[model samples]
Target: MCILVLNRASMTNEQYQSARLSRDSRFDGVFFVAVKTTGIFCRPICPANPPKEQNVEYFTNAHMALEAGYRPCLRCRPESAPNSWAWLGAETSFRRALTLIEQGALNQSSCEELSDRLGISSRYLRQLFKTHLGVSPKKYAQYHQLMFAKQLLHHSMLSISDIGFACGFNSTRRFNDAFKKTLNLTPSQLRRHGLDKEARNVVYLAYRGAYDWQSLLSFYQKRAINGIEKVTDTSYERYVEISGSLAWFKIFADHEGKQTVKIEFEMEDVTKLSTLLTTIRRVFDLDTDITAVESHLNGINHELIVHSGLRLPGVWSTWEAGVRAVLGQQVSVKAAIGQLNLLSESLDYRVSGQLVFPTPGVVSNADLSFLRMPQSRKDTLARLASHLREHCDDSPNNWLALKGIGPWTVNYALMRGQSEPDLFLSSDLIVKKIPKN
Candidate 1:
């Protein structure tokens, strides 16, 4: 194929230099530069040739990039980037704690469980948040609950009572009291409960920053399990299982104003809605502070661009991600990925219209050979998943006691599923074996 070339338009001096050099993708979600002359902000990895220096300016996010007079690049489509910061964001514990709190870890949970998840005492988790974020963990969690309630308030046409339940409040009276105290407004005042609106099933979700929607969508599209999920032009849908129940949710991105991306969700299983929303955010890596995360990670490995936008790719079910991890224990990434797909389709539950990965309870009793799985590894996956399904709720430290599941699987699941931030799998020998070149 013949190559075609285009002239440079406008970009910052530094950005033009970085683009020329193909610098890291860690800056994918951090900042974009809207060329004063051309009107496009791009991820560091954008393929367009370097623009004229001094014509560009940097922005904190894609939204900010647009607000500062630049449009999004068509090729890079910087919208759907996976969680931008590849670790290295500061105050790791705080972010991890924030993730857990958002997951409803504190809605009906005590400080001890939250603290234990952080591998710290309840006292320490509280002190850490107090010292850095100027709030207690419980108070922080309460703030999150209110913000979540605000999402339902602004998006869903559900009644204030339903909003309270969806946001994890135990009772409508409690929801009312908390709503008034937090927002100085009744939930009714915040809701959009018109008959027409509810008929369309519109519910808008609000978050703090401009997410790279295109970047995120593209990544998930490749890894999306065929029948289990959908990634459309306007929305994303997937499965989540929580507390012995399963549910499906769709996040629709319809409008944008101010600094927020409005996402609307429609859930099929109302009973686990609280947990479902929390998990969806984690699985999609929505609650992350992309700007801060991108900046810190970029500061470390300036050339980690290709892998910088690489997200932790949270899993919907612990048992499922764990088994995938186990099958990959001694294999290359490609081999592991292919084998995982085969295993899922071969033996997982599929009658639900969509193929739902069989839960721990359902698969624990399964015969390994039926999965066409390796004979040696069959019992290991079955038992480990079973142990987690049974003891994931046991008091602190039971994770370490599981027979075939070690730090790799446990930490991976906790970090991916529970959104535990500091749970790093840093010491795996196989991981260390990758050539440092």
Candidate 2:
């Protein structure tokens, strides 16, 4: 029953005008409208007086608007807009390239290196970005970094220098220069206009549409790994490992609205912020296009429409998902948790009260005689661990070839592990029991 709008880049002039006039929240990130008179671009939901059709120009993204010489509206903070899910266009290479860009791909390497990693030429990669996003990969990455820096300025207590480095800027001077060049304001001036002083190491993330918090919490609760993760009625807590250091973070929904989630962490290294935020977005499926998902599910089941915001929860890592899937085969959820908890307790690494899941090397080398599972399952686990350790660049096809991993397990892992939306478990007993039309 959800009304699906056309992709932002494809929206007609009239459609953009209508959305802007009405101040529609659904169109917040879809496209931004730049007022020629004011020389500022604002999210569709901005409360400012609407500009006349002649003075307003629609931009597919904030980057495009910036390229057109329009400054971001301070009142609307286009930087705070939920990411446009439509940016993940139809091309596989485009999506993968975008993902890499979000992970600070250009900060560490050139476009040629990135293209080499994606198995495409640098020219073709540039073409993909220009064709779909209307900007080069470098521009997209730069815009994203600036946006993240802006978010930190408005939300965190980090100093301007720290915020710059945290957002992937190589030097404080460069960060200040970029801010002044792009927004006509210094970092400190922007921070002065931010919300109340934030507690150290906390950031808020925005998402579009109505998020089914209870459903998402329940999903994590059912699969919560002892010593590694915990799900409470109000928050989810987990231990995270980065650069050989272990830290904990907690996530809870904002009580004021369903549009944002708060992430509180105790990480000492600010440079890991980009990687951590990317993982959080993936784990929560914050970028899903709920309207498109509902339209696709409309013919199959009416109930699915009612619960369209129920996201596909993702794991912290593919290795964790695969290991959990292997442990869960043929066992009840509770039984699998018991075994997993025991395995974690037996592992070598421990921080606070939490245990880092054993690495592939550790799992493959450790003795499994203590586990109560069958010998065949134990052997399968060993083989999987060894395979993962040896083949660091293994694909899903390689995963499918491993012993004791069936189609169901592989599909389940892909769905949660890689955030693949199209994989459905039609053979699941619960899915099979659903009434047919």
Candidate 3:
């Protein structure tokens, strides 16, 4: 496939060249540099000596580079680059499709099935991928699967067979053949050496731009559910349920001043690894392009944004977020957290020595009379849980139709649950109380 160069939507090729020359971390995942002489692609932050501008070409994303017949540079490890929304353009359908693919939509299903989920034809979906990303949707999905498997091989202590299964390969032989054919490297050859000293459950997630971990951590610490979550000086830990089993995941911000954070998770059903990682990314707001956000905010008013690396601190799921918002209504953060703990303790169960949050089904059937909250709030929680169970949709708009749910609850769910970027809290007391200067 012929490669598509940098379009008007993205930065100019000269800017990209300058970024590669300076090894700018901000452009790490925004664009990839492929060397025509060597037939290899590398992240802009790759440490190798820069290739002459005449000999290098730029692709919008790693998939595009791979589709252009360039093997990934082993030194830069393009597989571990931060996932970027910059590469996903303004096409809402395409963006949604990409999100679904990352969440393992194509793992056990076909592109037609994926498009069916999006209410579009498979052919148009392929055209969207081709127009925006310079590759077919299937190729993009396969690239992600392979890249994720490579990342696991180089970082995690998972065995090769387990990695294959986790990445959606049915067997070891198929995994090996596909790995060798695509990446031109055997799984064993790509696995990092000296694994004995590494944390078996640990993997580093890279990000671009400044990340205000302290601020985000403090926000979580103040409102954290005591038994379900633990926020400390340098890390955030929480118990989560994955694939019907109890699991716990933690993020450590001690990257020694690097633009990456380490995550450690332990769970059953390794096949659900992709789903777990997707949730972790959302919870941390990893996919945000903070530079763009800051630029836009700065244009509106320089004083509007206070922190350098501000991000949306998202909840694990819409259901959990809805419950939290319902319990938090007309109460202090401390009181809301207490109610959350009470609800979890009453309905939650323990497995593998970790506590898992109560599911919607559990909350729907239980009479939450033990909590020190108003009856109306309890009814709202029940109605929300029942709506979730019956409709199988988590859109915030749908919640507005339910009784006892209002704009605040829906907006809270949208802001925290989905990490929506644009929201104006005119009805908030604090927002309204601010002096009109």
Candidate 4:
């Protein structure tokens, strides 16, 4: 069993009681309240009557509650709670392991393989999981898969078998067995009771706190690639390619009151759903704790924090971000996008009403006579592309070894591509002038 480690700064038992009593949406995913009387756990914002404080115990995460033998509350649907990982206070390895697990690292591979990727021994990896999360990495991965499936079961019109396969269960029997054994509820039963019958190919992803939809949308609107990405006043839609499969998705902000963003998606490969959802969450910065982030930023310098709930809007992939950054060097946003349009028009692949960004291989070999830029800049773009193609490495830190890939280009790619949070654009001309003011 996981030991409860409470500190003054962390959410105390009284705080949990208060938040659940008031049904605070901000604390929805921060912790779970497991009611011993009901033998179930629920999100803090559950609409069901709050259990008596004496009968409830707080678990820092849904996994801990589940492991403690508490089934998820069907009414509250704990699976749909916002997935903010920052508050876990875990080190990089544990966090990376969780990311890998979400990407199905343990679905078809062994724990040894996972530890190998992390450059650690399997024993050490297990130790890490036990110490922090109080469960083996395998158990954590399995719980997440089931949670994702539960989310789909409640929100999507996908068939039971399809949801099973989509969530990485090899067969329907296995999925059903695991679902029943762990959640104490059958998938069919949950679907019958909880599913939104009207939903079709739609999944609502949750988030906590204020969201500056206009600010993030405006940022994307300025740089959206035509035919690939489209930004509207109330929604953002894009054609996406993940793990060699193509899909299209649109996200609407109108689900504001529910504390979730509505995602209407169409994809042929159901198995890729988990990865696609993870990508969507990261790209939209859905998993960030805005309250904590804003508080930290305000402490830095109040003036530096311009907008509330402004998230780090991410590009599709690191490769795409690197290409955009190279094109944007020392240029206005308009100029950079113009060059990008020219480049995309020249080399991008088109199907139906959509266009796929040019691959590193395509950009590396392309002649730059069409782009109206200095020859040196064109050469730099080609060099960066060639390096990425040859090495298959997208990390900005690795890109620093290349010429013309300076701090600004690397930082831009890290910020927009990888959604890295701790970046200081001190080299930027505008940022450099901030101290003068």
Highest lDDT scorer: 4
Model 1, 1-437: lDDT tens digits are: 11111112233455545643463443444445566777766765577775666776765445445434455554554543323332234477777777667677787889998887778888878887766546677766665566556655555566777768767789999988976665555767655332235323344333334455666777566556655677876667876445545556676653554323444445554535656655665676655654444555667876655543334557776556677767766666666666666666766675335567666666677666754446666777777767866765442235556556567766766776555666667766666877888
Stretch of 10 with least lDDT, candidate 1: 1-10
Model 2: which ten-residue window has the lowest total lDDT? Answer: 1-10
User: On residues 257-359, what C-alpha lDDT tens digit does candidate 2 reach at each position?
Assistant: 8478888877667777888888898999887767566766786776667665778889987777888878878787888878887887887566444577777
* Stronger candidate by lDDT (1 vs 3): 3
In candidate 3, position 165 carries an lDDT of 88
Candidate 3 local lDDT, 183-255, one digit each (tens): 8889888774423356587777888778899999999999887678999989999988876777778899848
How far is 49's C-alpha from truth in model 3 (Å)?
0.7
lDDT, each prediction: 0.59, 0.81, 0.82, 0.85
Q: Per-residue lDDT for 185-225 in model 4, tens only? A: 89999999998978999999989778999888889999999
**Candidate 3 global CA lDDT score:** 0.82
* Estimated TM-score for each candidate: 0.61, 0.93, 0.94, 0.93
lDDT of 4: 0.85
In terms of TM-score, the best-performing candidate is: 3
Kindly report which residue stretches of model 1 are placed more than 4 angstroms away from their true locations once superposed: 1-101, 105-141, 192-218, 232-235, 252-264, 268-271, 297-302, 306-310, 330-355, 393-437
